[model samples]
Target: MYLTQGLHRSLQRHPDKPALRHVGDGDVRTHTFAELLRDTGQHAAALQARGVKAGDRVALLAPNHDRLVRALLACWWLGAVACPLNVRWSAPELAYAVSDSEASLLVVDEALAGLVRELPLPVIDFEQLAQEAQGLQALPDVRAGGDTLAAILYTGGTTGRSKGVMLSHANFWTASMTRGAELNNAPDSVSLLVAPLFHVAGLGRLVGQTLVGGTCVTMAHFKPAAVLEAIERHGISDVVVVPTMLQSLLDDPGFAPERVRSLNRIAFGAAPMPPDLLERALQAWPHAEFFQAYGLTETAGAVCINLPDNHRDPAALAQGRLNSVGRAGLGAEIQIVDESGRELPAGQVGQIIVRGPMVTRGYWRLPEASAEALRGGWLHTGDAGRMDAQGYLYIVDRLKDMIISGGENIYCAEVESVLRTHPLVSQAAVIGRPDPHWGEVVHAVLVLADGATAEQLPLPVLRDWCHERLAGYKCPRGLSHVPALPLSAAGKVLKTVLRQQLAA
Candidate 1:
């Protein structure tokens, strides 16, 4: 199915309904379904005027905004692929994604417009785009469907590079439909889109809401106070958050159980949720249903979901249901398999694999990697997890040394690479350290250069240096000065030994 079909349905079903409420630092702005569609048409015409044809890739660099949403629809309306660059990434990181995607045009919000000024492609902000589309006729829908490429989302790779995960229109539709009320609620549901749309979870939620003819409340930036304000003002019925965001909201001074009483559903995932925080959350919102979803960028969205029923009873956590990522979602087949692709029996920890309509086609222009990932007709998740006899999935560990800090995936190798570039660093080994608030934070073990001493580079100094090269989340939150890293015979860092020594 086409992505814009829901917009059409909403247009016919409830033209005057509030389709979007954008909560920027300025005054809140709401858009009706008809207005949304009208704005999308104008944006589509603007793209067409710039000679953006079907199959062309358009890059968007911005936070959550109604204009960004409309621009996404505009791309789909013309059968073009929309590639949203991660806002947290540095200029070089974003440049890499844009270059890899081969985007035809770049869309930006004013705040980030300057970072991309040097790029060769045409750059236009939303305001200018709207002004340019003033009198242009609306472009007719191309009706792109099935395997037609819809988006190119960039995710960190094992090689310390970013890979563009190519998701089609069908993949998005299947994932959204299968997710259903688990993430999406009733047709009239009002969802707060606080999560950045560049990620699959956030994009999937948006599609899920659209599929059900629901209203979306966009946030230009996520602030605990702003989220509370939006929920109280709009009577938001549904929300999707990571554990970090959840704890921050609860800890925010303005947070009152009464302010968020309108919330009926809260879908959380993307990182491990601390049990203590989850327990506190359950206590805080007794009336709200909480669920956890497990998925990858390759799966478009939810592969497995721990339903709200699993979280209702306190004993469920002791019984193991609450700790699980849940059983395979509708239309998804999840299995734990060995190296030879043989499915392991229950209780056997192995690689988690998923096969379903939601699975993405492959990495953009990386056929060998694509073939390797999708071999045996199942997408290898590179995550170590186990399944119970009753079908609940428990994630044990990550096969890849990837750290999830504050809901952002930080590849250890990538962080190590950046750290190695420092003049004072002779060698570096990066690992994830469990943190109460951020799920897991990046921690490093470093070997000083020949003339450098431990006092030469402090944690604060290194953090500022790394922030210049990498995203703040990926920067090392703490570090230890070591003579040398513990290495295996294969010349790989022995992360377990480092963890053991650190713990001791």
Candidate 2:
């Protein structure tokens, strides 16, 4: 049940198979399963030599690279917990994570080495470590128990400062196995890894692919042209992207039906895809199966996936089932519960809670936060959602994002969904602004389509558009145009950032 258990299986079953292919800055390098295993062993030995004993915390601050993957696997091999730091974080933020985790050593990419110079921990250059480990003997096997901590992944701090979500080997292994089974991952599958490995979804995809002996092609960073080129060149069969990345891919001039003809599946999550964008993607890559997954960092990865069949079925789209994040994944239990923690009935929106082996143990060193989040033995997802009689989970919006206007609760997602339907709108985000009379009023920030101006969608016109599709209170009272929305590393709209801008 250990995370590296599958890697050992892959080593024995497909030693010569291509395991990792890294594409960075026009350089392409690959490692066979055998090579990756050897590298993992060497990395483990190097870590041991550097005083990273079993149970030690090793922090990684690097972009996507083969060495980064090897470093993570090596940490698991040595029974050490790996803490992946977001590259987008500032030095102060990184300092907080490193100090909170009590990391003994930091492995940083050369590009980011400057950021960690002032940090107290001993630092190891990622490339230099690989060079040093080239001829080192393999470290002895040190297997970890299923419940042993494997990684401490920091949550994207949309609400506040980030907290480390401690995930055990069982948590990751369960998530990988469940996702692999549901997605029908196979040994021959070539998955393009475009998401940042610092995120759970990115790391989870790598683990899931490895569990089934699939080939993973890593991209240093996501660029629409580069992604399309990689797909065409490598004949990538599987890809996982967030809504923003999907939109960029569709908008890229290099994107075409022929470029991604080899794709067998495309899984999207982290945020809901606009209907217009999803429809465009479906048409452009008609041969590719589409899936939408739903999960938080605390769950390790996806616990619910909207299946390909549901995405392709026109009837399902008309019924709004396509908008759902799908049923509970294998071995996952999902429930909608009220504020008092009683389970809510189907068709009633409430908090979404999940219980499964895939869920994390708790946040690192944050007892109160952990207890509050994992209350009643379920991970309380602060999301407003409802389950249908047939078990489809429809996410309305984050409970925090709900706008309370004059005693009315307005879900921003509902308004954003309608706004996206307009041809002139490229992107839209709804937030609440202070109001003297209503307490809070709905405010819409929009990115117009190319060649379109803010004048094309004035407040009155946007108001009329929303009025046609929503109740009066739900319609945004104010409208503003932005060239782009602030996005998290996972390609989700950063509502916190939007709120700050509005406040200023």
Highest lDDT: give the candidate number.
Answer: 2
Question: What is the TM-score (0 to 1) of candidate 1?
Answer: 0.81
How displaced is residue 292 in candidate 2, in Å?
Answer: 0.7
The segments of candidate 2 whose C-alpha lies over 4 angstroms from its true place after superposition are: none
TM per candidate comes to: 0.81, 0.98
- Give one digit per residue, the lDDT tens place, for model 1 in 386-456: 89998999986677666778887676756776787788886677888889999989999998878898888
**Candidate 1 Cα errors over 4 Å, as ranges:** 157-159, 181-184, 314-318, 402-504
Candidate 2: 10-residue stretch with minimal lDDT: 177-186
Q: Give the alpha carbon lDDT tens digit for every residue of 1-504 in model 2.
A: 877776789889989999999986889999999998889989999998899999999999988888899999999999999999999999999999999999999999998999889999899899888987888999966878589999999988778888999999899888887787777787899999889988999999988887778899999889999999999999899898998898998999988888789987999988868888898988888888999999988999999989898988879977888899999999899999999999999899899999999999999999999999998899999999999999999998899999999998899888899999888999999999999999999999999999998888899999998899899889989888999999988788999899899888
lDDT of candidate 1 vs native?
0.85
lDDT at residue 401 of model 2 (Cα atoms): 92
